[model samples]
Target chain A: MSRHRARRSGLLRAVLSLGLLVGVGVSGTMAYWTDQATVTTGQLAAGRLDLTLNGQLAGPGGSTTDTTFAVGDLVPGESFARAISVGNAGTVPLDYTAVSHTNGTLGPGLRWTVVAGGAASNAGSSANGDRTGTCTGGTTTFSSASAISANAAAPTPVVPARRPLAAGASETLCVIVRLDPSAPSSLQGATATATFVVNGVQRGAP
Target chain B: MSRLRVVVLNAGALLGVLCVLVAAALWVTGSRPLVVQSDSMAPEIHAGDLLLARSIPAADLEVGDVVSVVDGSGVRVTHRIIEVSESGAERIVRLRGDANAVADPDAYTLSRAERVTWVLPGVGSAAAFVDSTPGRVTAIGIVAGCWLAVVLPRRRAPLHARPRRRRGIAPVLVGAALLLPAVLPGARAWAIFDDTATVATAPLAAHRVVAQGQPQCRNEGGLFGVGEYVRLTWPHVDVRYEYRWEARHTATGEVVRSGVVQPAGGRPGELELRSSVLDLGLGATTYDVVVHARLRAAPSWEAAGTTTQVRTSAVLLGLGVRCA
Candidate 1:
């Protein structure tokens, strides 16, 4: 009788092991049940988010390559405007703002303004000409005219109306820089060059 | 043969159990293993580093903490907090990547933020791959393979077979391994949730300064006779600068006239010099009048002085100005 009992116990242990193995196998496919079909939404993959500024004036929908620009040779009451093409080169959408840095004695008298999706009049060229320009139509996203101290301290948003530039989309940024008409004449013949940096971040809440 | 079968079964069981437990624990804790894709945060947290972040109340957050926030487009960004402002029940947080030059352009208003609690450098790439479709398929295949390997072999031998003490420890080891990452979040809760501070900078842009006009030449009465007077006007001038004008006979190379003029009352801005030129002694000879001005406190990168020169010949009686 004891021999029979031991044999039964051995058989029971084998069955339990087999059940555990089957359970593991069944678990893999158990995510689906009867009368159900998998509608694959799509494969999952990681994406990148990036912002690019093309100072080359490469035209609308400009090259997504990165570059820089310099606003030079300005006189009081004169302004210079450049159409910088800002592009979203990454797979994810992003919004961007512009910050200006001035270096030289003439820096104090210079004013920066950025307009998005607008027409620039008498836009200044790199070569010496009339150094005055203005933006019309679109939106005046930032103007250092009224709040010089407060404006200089904070970054100015370019696309306030239709922000969060979609991926693969590019927009023309009319960067208008003018020397204050009231600037003292002492700032003349002295150079104050500027660098405009476009800072981008993932789109924020609506 | 039976000994070999037992070993394979035990090994397969160990692997299968580990995979399930670890995967389940990750899901239960709501932990996401993200692979950083940019070098915006460097040195301490770099691109390709695997980050495990846990959620915390926004009100509990303070400045200087590294957190992950979701943007409107559903993108997760990891950055350090530079500012935190409270508006009623809402918290507005400004963030900047450790490696970025400026704070992020947009601020986040949230009730909760996912603060990074763990970092495993250089492991993000592998984790990213494993999270992909092909990688998940491969993992499932591996688990299924282990299950099959453990279950296939059957032994019909003696009854009351005792399990080895060494074999019993495998489950314990697997349990511990799976529990480490899960338990760490709670065990070192304070260390993982601590906040860190950061700084920001604001800069202004300027336009270029160009010259619209230059110095000119005119005739003026001198001590000796009718002399050539040169007027030099500069757009930029400092209070401490002094302007000097000198004329030399081009033919004989002799210094004709030289004098210094001080700025009026230590004033800054447009400075001018009006000086009469002395005759070249040689009748009707051409001479060059040059103005040199120096700034006492000019910066090291700038030229200490500026020079302007104009060439002219005597016109109205030997000292008359006639620029050619």
Candidate 2:
């Protein structure tokens, strides 16, 4: 009985150890738990700092003119007044600085002064030749146009005023331009083309 | 005896004896074993290796000793001790992993048992399975049948035939070996359960500090208020994590701005801070910022985090003026 019991116990112990060893070996090989989760692609695209320039001009009897206007038969001291609206069409809050540049000889003799903040007017078309406006908002001077730069590459700001333009916000300005009265005879029939560059920078970015 | 047969039997008996001796020694030691759960201590101790550990005085703990410690989240972890600081009655210990290039994110208080005495490789997986529902059922059935085997013969023996004392202890020893892991602390979490769920603290917090490699907006100091993203952090398992945040109307719970944030591989206590300036553009409305983490581990690990209230002010871009 003693011999039988000893042999049985030994066999049981052997089998138990063998079973645990095999179980543990298989479990280690299985290696079930260590895992990783991958997140889907999510790119936080930065908001853009941009603004669009829209303008209209009105002359005698509320006649409107486009941005590129032919002041038809220009004479000495002939002037034009325009109501230009700058709109913030981008997703970020921004500020803008307007500058005037030219590749032609017409920019030097044309004196321009800008005053921002006027009620948006529909009395003039942004396409026609009516260059006079009816805006009496803020008296803040925006900028002064520069002398002509032939073949110019850079558009310099007339006045470095970064006017804050909130997202989807619009600003109307009272811009008045006048031709020099005491002009020389050599300036006759001189066609001057001026390009206004409106640059917007995200607020606090500058 | 046939030479090859004799050799084969001799080899089998030797292996059997070795197996029995090893199992018996493990059973008798009563060494509470903790399983390696992650690859943090890889190469030295692979995942699923059974580690037998006992607490030693922090003062006696030396550098380079691999020790296990519980983090703030109550997760058991093992790392090698690298530094120990002693000031008056206090001892502060710092630990790092052999597989990791950087040290642990947080230093541990010198009050925990960190020294490890023994390691039985790859047995933790088996122990874990045995601690499961089906495993327990099978173990109980085997134990009950073995006990019957020992008792039935004793009942049929003659009056002069007596059961020996060692035989009586053998079954008890086997029973103890099977149930060893069930009695240990911290080992219970590793055991498989039907639901396989866990309760965790809020995993996210709001902050105003800038995170590295994130774009910073400038106009926030004015009317367009600037704020940081809800930061999500964990105490263990360095893996790339995912989370989403939203700004919703406080009164109606309407989502105002929402987006997801995913940061690449991070270690314990490493914060995954993400906030988009465009998303934080709350306008003039007061909204609550709600964010949480999703650890999508097989069954997923989740946490319910807190919310923050933010209000934006008015702005006049034409006048270049910001209102309060």
Candidate 3:
């Protein structure tokens, strides 16, 4: 009994001493260099995706700076072309596209074709500063309108590499809207409006 | 003839088996170990420590993971990932040292696990030394000599040789000798930085100081972001800290930006020695930041009509365990 008691007391004493040493060591005696640093707590916001439309928007008016793309009256088989330029003002590159939505009975009688860099590419790649969004020699035409054509199915995309417009760069698009030459005379009094909607998203992540 | 002898022999056999098993497991896992050589990640990790890292993809890395990557010039750096940018199939990772005040001067591409998962302290110093040319030769000679001393003596002994009285002691001694390497020296370098008094007029009252004691035994990666800010403290009010900051080119290891800060006044709180904002310029090259913290303590005395002083330094006395 005494032997067991002695051993227990000794063990308890050792534990107490260890606990005391650990406490003292943790509370008061560091004589070495210590370092502490933290990153300021904040979330990195995504880059801006601002796309601007300039130049002539083909519509009712010939080449007005007006926001309304109003193509007043067009005789059957007549074709009208207008030059429009899209610029990326944001810091990062952007993927942009243009789509037209029509509302009227004559909507099916019209067809459109888009040619990129119709005039911008003439300046040459090195002729100016910040021309990342400038379009190359690429063209896409929508000949017929589907009965239920939504945004994606009817949109015209810029040329490859030109699709992602670089920051501070612009692309000039020449859109030709024409009334199909085979349109019947039954659509004479029908009026239609084609609204050009441009959409853009940043190419890479934040 | 004794249980003690039987136990020692069994323990030795067990240890040998365990060593082989562990080595095989590490090999199968494809994990590699590297030695740390600087205090850029001090407090969390230290110089003369070995790090076990597994191969992992850069895309899967998180912001706070400590990863090892090669800079543009092919310099291997271990730092925490602060930001990541993806370019096509590759990832451009930006790293920052924990003790740094800013981001790395440049970023690195992460394609492998070189990410640190385990830190084995003090033993790395011996491993590093042994890996060198002269050290390697000396180690091989010692191992070979020890093997010969044991095997040759046993081979020469008769098959029916008389039993030795000290046979039991031999196994115990041999077991102890083999277990010595795994004991691992407890001493590692760490410092305390008290930034509580940084605000001149109304300093924050106090910081919970974790008093790490002197290790009875003794035995050190990178990017940079906006520069990092670092702080170190002296426990008393009468101490001087002399610190030097060096920014070296990762590839050629040339010092580019170097400066030293020696505080004129001795105060009882942590000192902020570096600022977090860094101006590394826009370049693809990476730089490494190294800090040299030296503390000088002076106690006052009376001599003649003026007060004289005795200087004693309270520098480098803690185990590298807790992070400030």
Name the candidate that leads on DockQ: 1
| Ranking, DockQ, top scorer first | 1, 2, 3
Query: What C-alpha lDDT do the candidate models reach, one value each?
Result: 0.51, 0.46, 0.42
Residue-level lDDT tens digits of model 1 in B1-324: 556544444444444444445445545775545556555666587655667666788898889888877666544667889999997777899987775556665799989887777787666554444444454454445444444544554455566767433334346346546533321111111000101111111222333232222454433444444454544555434343445556676666677777665657544233222223455443445655555553322211122334344454445554545443
Q: Per-residue alpha-carbon lDDT of model 3 for A1-206, expressed as tens digits? A: 23344234323322222222221222112111111211111211223445666732321112223332334334444444555777676665766655555556666666666676563222212111111212235565333443213243453332323266797898766655555545554554456555555554445311
For B44-103, candidate 2 gives per-residue lDDT tens digits of 776566777666677777788877676665545578889988855556777766654335
Which of the numbered candidates is closest to the native, going by highest TM-score? 1
Prediction-by-prediction clash tally: 10, 15, 32
lDDT score, candidate 2 = 0.46
**Taking the tens digit of each residue's C-alpha lDDT, what string does model 1 give over A54-90?**
5332211122322234444443456766666667776
- Model 3's lDDT to the true fold? 0.42
Give the residue spans of candidate 2 off by over 4 A.
A1-206, B1-31, B150-324
- Provide DockQ values for all models, in the order shown: 0.08, 0.01, 0.01
Find the 10 residues in a row with the least total lDDT in model 2 chain A: A56-65
Per-residue lDDT of candidate 2, residues A115-160 (tens digit): 7775533243322212243446766564444453434365445435
- Docking class for model 1 is incorrect
**Local distance difference test, candidate 1:** 0.51
Judged by DockQ cut-offs, is candidate 2 incorrect, acceptable, medium or high? incorrect
Better of 1 and 2 by DockQ: 1
